[model samples]
Target chain A: MLEKTGLPTDDDLKKVIPDKERLAKGAVVIIECFQKIPCDPCAISCQFGAIKPFKDINDLPQVDFNKCTGCGICISACPGLAIFVIDNNYSENKALIKLPYEMLPLPEKGKEVYALDRAGKIVSKAKVVRVQKIKNKTNIISISVHKNMAMKVRSIKVEDKKNEG
Target chain B: MKKTNLAIIGGGPAGLSAAICAASSGAKITLIDDSLELGGQLIKQTHKFFGSKKQFAGIRGIEIAKNLLQEIKKYKNIELIGNATVTGYYEDGILTIVQGSNGDIFIKLLPDRIIVATGASENMLTFVNNDLPGVYGAGAVQTLMNLYGVVPGNNVLMVGAGNIGLIVSYQLLQAGIKVEAIVEALPRIGGYLVHASKIRRLGVPIYTSHSLKEVYGNDGVEKAVISEINKDFEFIPGTEKELKVDTVCLAVGLSPLSDLLWQAGCQMKYIAELGGYVALRDDHMKSSLDNIYIAGDVAGIEEASSAMLEGKIAGLNAAVSLGYRVDNFLELNRNLRKELEELRANPLSEKVKIGLEKALLKREVDQ
Candidate 1:
């Protein structure tokens, strides 16, 4: 018998996805922390208190969209690299996405990168707008992709050395 | 025989924290490790940790090791010794440690209190061609890729779906290594869902109810074959599929290294939940043997965070036994236990609870 595999499905995504109004407002946090594990660095990293304190360590984090300023500090603070900030209001045809990146040869600002979805398939072309290496642990990289690709994109393709050469 | 107040067997997170805490409590501490540098497995863990700030959350494991090493250096009473292996623990708190590469140097230490924190060893799956050179432990892969910057192989087949398997799969991607697949005999992912999600999102297929049946190669691992298994873990007929891969990484499980505990005559019991035979210890981490304590994986296999907490408790209590007045010992112990409880309260921690209960039951029986 097949059992629950733990990967997020569309149904699971619906639970943590920001509302239409919040998504349209341009800045929102999408927490993909599906498991009830003992982790809460995201809550403490949020300066606006948007991420509520977990009643229990295994409790799912609740995000008050109103208080969330989308400062993106929690992007790097998340040990799981599951917290993401998306802004649909970047432009009429583009959206901004900030993800935790930890690979070497960090992507540079204004560089073109391939945005990959949950399955790691290249979904759209994206441009790196910002790369912040905080405390040399989790690096927060913000990229601008097509508005429709904002919700689908999770990571940027790291250029392989051999491929680069 | 030189006398010391305390002798800590391992210098990983547990031993490092114990050395710092014990030394701070006025006990002369001698911390010895088998590695050239300290930080046991922490040296290879590149991912950030999750916990409260008090536990140094948001910090990478490598950074945590560096910070702990720096903190331990502050105490003049604690002596840090690397490249030393504790060969044996004998009667009267005597420890025979062989130092140097050739094991030529022998040092006999007689400490009033001994803390066994000698971590654990990775478990390997038994199968055809399992002895091939390319077949490596998941920890060895991390040590090679993350620590030594050597790519384990171009293509890898991870043979476990636990935290180590999932985390190593992600790290393999970080090192630009391709993970062909992860085959687990369990019906579902055994680790945290977040870890499984991370690797799944990276397009790594996790095959549950599947087991690595054979590793095919002559000089090294050239390919691997997996098959579906039944509830009894018996391989189903006509379900085998060969995976083209160069490396077969095993993350089956970890067995606690409790040889010294047994040699020292500490009461040991076979507890499957604790991942093998473990020394019986009270909540204070003191074994049935007087002045001998156990912590970290040596006591039971658990996360680094819990191991560090166990080390601190054992260290504080050991100091107290050594006539050191630890002002906040009780309060600190209570808080540490609370934090450990919080970390272990998840539904997935039911097994951990069972393991802890078995170990604790033995402790009560001994008392």
Candidate 2:
């Protein structure tokens, strides 16, 4: 389904999502990479021993949820931009999602934007909470969305006037 | 006439790695490239590479080129020749080169060993008005935007769903250009899903099982027509759709630039899976001729990581053939081979594996 639609199917997402108990706790990393490509940067970038060591470079990353602190260091390190950090305990009705953003005109903090789902459909309105520009061009942007839309919102679109430039 | 132990043609990732490996093992090297600066296509790639850590996984291609150049600088035995083109390689072991701004300078080299690492050229598609001024290859677009910071056009239609097409679309957005859509002839997206997802979430629609019907304009591209295709690649008559765009980028595929190998008379075969004609070589990358070596896209179309690994193998083997004293030669050679095997072990590399099987020549028992 991912090959045809370019978006992971529910079955694909089911394999990588943390259990309900883990989600209720705090922030955790979600790797949406389902292919067997020859890459292992996530394991190397993780400070904690959450991502298991890759027996072969082509092996998919195996994350140990117990050790995962969801520091979000691996978000920008992924070349595919397939990794994300979800914090369900952000607020009573809001959740925070950290994603890799490489586009220009970085969204200003506290600015409202349209949050999009996997297929790029507008799902909800979100506010930018954090924008960390790393040494690499892949910057990390965290947005606070409705708690029910935490897993669905994967990207944000800013409608600033300057973006027309 | 100038002479060296090993002469590397094309200063891309493969050639740079070859020069560094051979030079470190005491084989004086002359690394030649047509561009004034080195790094070939890598200098223009903005996206990070995907491979193991040893191959610099998660590092941008531009940074990888920088690291290779810095590593090459450490080898005093290595000499770099820029703005120089290797014109011909004669049977008598002489290579003619043309250098200088006007290409008026002529030079000859009689190196003991020659490694051909010439890369690839982008393939163009056939369609009405494809020759318009606004039409461009993906590589040209990358060179223009990433290298010179020049945006190609306001709106564009990409003609492939491969990694290059997807990545270039993302880059165009970064450059503030609007991507109308992407059309691919295949039913399923040919590139990695992650790359497709990256662009899709940004609102660029990819039309699989679709082909560019035509482009129409007076002096430049003003609009494009695309239509859905069937399993046999036949265009569906009523499925045509028009998109207004100033530029059309073709990222269909690439063919190996193996003219030097053909001139050298190394046994060659046309392998569609490999992207074109490639030189038949052994595991060490030695061509039919004892002193001739081949690597990178010239040997077979593959990723930069595999190309770098092949370069190391070819460089070390070429040096060893010249009696260079490398204490751990066998061990290093085995490790490089293992790494290359691991890199190509995935299902994505199935085509490359099939191509290699046909191009790989068996080594004789008596060297």
Clash count per candidate: 1, 0
Pairs in steric clash, model 2: none
Which regions of candidate 2 deviate over 4 angstroms? A163-165
Please provide, for model 1 over A41-66, each residue's C-alpha lDDT reduced to its tens digit, 9 standing for 90 to 100.
Answer: 88988899899987877677899998
Kindly give the stretch of ten consecutive residues in candidate 1 chain A with the minimal lDDT sum: A1-10
Interface RMSD of each: 2.3, 1.0
**Docking quality (DockQ) for each candidate:** 0.57, 0.77
Best by TM-score: 2
Error of model 2, residue B156, in angstroms: 1.2
Q: Distance (Å) between predicted and true CA of B259, model 1?
A: 0.6
